[model samples]
Target: MNTSSEPGDSLEKQAGISLREARQTQLLKVFLVMSVIYTLYLAKTLFIPLVFSAFVALLLSPLVALGRKIYIPRTISAFVLIGLLIAPFSFLGVELVKPAERWMETLPKISAQITEQINEISEKFEQEQNQAEIQAEAERKQKEAEEASFFDNWFKDDEPEAKVEEVKEVKENVVTGQIKQGSIEIFLSLLASAPFLIAQMFGSVILILFLLIFGPVLFKIFIQDFPVVVDKERTVQLVGQIQKRLSNYIITISMINGLLGIATATAFYFLGVEDAILWGALVGMLNFVPYLGGLISCTILLMVGVVQYGLVSAAFLPPAVFLGINILESQFITPAVLGQSFRLNPLIIILWLAVMGWLWGVIGVLLAVPILVCIKIILEHLDVLPHWVKLLESEG
Candidate 1:
């Protein structure tokens, strides 16, 4: 009886120890993951351009490879490709300048119109209020006005005209000083950031060019290091699949956005909307942010419609049409083109977008889906985390 009891006690002790160790290991992993996320957040400036360059290189690599087949130098081909990529955007920017300026100039008018409409609505609603309520509101306003007037009289000078002029001068000086100080602060901030911005831009370009030049050779070097033949082949296949999917997704999405922009511009122009190109460009760019982006674009279009066409049946048409086009694109065109490979769970995508957008702002939002696609491809190929893959996949 004593010997049997000893053996059972020993077995129970061993099991408890093992369970404790497993819990510790899980906690350690959680700590390490938190640390890594913090590090990424701190070092985003360095990493943002690096990640952007990697994606751009992935997108442009096939063209560079084709150039190599024709005996064109990678450097030349890269430069030409970058130039071609920037040209359309540069043209769009140039075309947007006048419209943007006009919009800025008309903003005051828009504000006034909006205010007028609001006042009109308020007046109409005011008529619906009972006489007692209206009288009470009027009395309240009169009391406040009388209190304000008392304060003004208490501070009044004997010569009212001179006092008013002096007050105006003082207010003007205060306003001018604030504007000047704000302008200076803004200028200084931009001045300080200019170098970093320029360096980041140049660095991204150089990185893209280097990647384009040496990407194939680098792949070869990477696979050469695998110890076993099976591992080597797996790595090669994995990298190939990731590259193919990423490049195709980027290229396909870009073409879709370009077409959407063109269609939007044409539709807006025919709708007699001013600054059609600007709105079109904005819609295309913001569409990158998935669900949130479309909502924002619709809201902006709605505002433009209200401001440009006033509160009429015509005002609602622009956003309604925009919503329709976006629905058609998102529902039909994207599904047909991308198919199932790049499809991710909607919840997972939203969470990832929120996390990344918090971490890296707009660029992070744009890169989020591509990064998820890369992760999905790797996980599927490695077969290590089937549950994670399931969570990521759109399948129920």
Candidate 2:
């Protein structure tokens, strides 16, 4: 009995040790993850431009290769492609400035007008409610009188306490003033940060040009240091697959978003929405961010519609049309075009977007999906991290 009990105790102690070891391993993993995230947040200014350049390089690498097949030098092809990419954006930026400024100047007035319209609707609703309540009260009193015995009537209090409701007033002028002040502050802050932002943009463009021209050569050199022929071949194949998957994803999504924007602008223009082109460009840019982007675009459209149409039934048309187009694009067009090539768990995508957004900002939110695609491609090609692949994969 003593020997059997000793063996059982030893088994229990071994189990306890294994549990402790597992807990330690998990803690280490958590710490490593936290450290990486903190580092990313700390170095965002440098990483943001670097990551953007790398992804852009991957996207344009195919075009550059095509140019090489035609005997165009990489440098010249890179410059030409970059110029083509920047031209339309620059034109759009120039075209949008006046409209953007006009809208900014009128924002306070728009806010006040929308508020006033809401107040009017609220007042009408309240009046109808008050009339219904009065009618119900009168009927209730009459029924009570009909049912009351003389003794009950004599026992009842002659007068009951009256309940008074406080009516809150919305001060449109005060709201407008606050909005105007806040806008002014925001504009000044943006003006102050313009130089830094421009510098980062310039750095990104230069880095992209360099990466587009020399990226392949650098990758080959890195692979050569692997020593074994099999390792070199595997590394090259891995890089190639990542580039292919990312390039296709970016190019297809960009085209889709561009078409979406064009459709949005055309619809808004026909609907007599002011600054239709600006809103179109905005929707296109914002669509890069999944989930949050469409919600924000719809909200802005709703407000703009209300302000423009002044609470009329037709006021919902702008956002309704925008929502319809978005539903078609996301649910129908995207699936048919992209299929499962870049699919990931929606939960994983949202979590990654949140992490990246917290670490960086709006640019991080835009880059999150592309980065995730690259990661998914890499993981699929490698045997390590099989569990991660399972975690990231979408369910059937």
The top-ranked prediction according to TM-score is 2
lDDT of 2 by residue, 172-271 (tens): 4566578777767777787798899999999999999999899888777767865555677767777788788778889999999999999999999988
**Can you give the lDDT of residue 369 in candidate 1?**
85
- 220-277 per-residue lDDT for model 1 (tens digits): 8767964554578767778778888888888899888878878888999998998888
Q: How many clashes would you count in candidate 1?
A: 0
Clashing residue pairs in candidate 1 (N, C-alpha, C atoms within 3 angstroms): none
RMSD of 1: 6.6
The reply for model 1, stretches above 4 Å from the true place, is 101-116, 126-131, 136-199, 225-230
Candidate 2: residue 324 Cα off by (Å): 1.6
Number of clashing pairs, model 2? 0
Q: List residue ranges in candidate 2 displaced over 4 A.
A: 1-22, 123-174, 226-230
lDDT of 2: 0.85
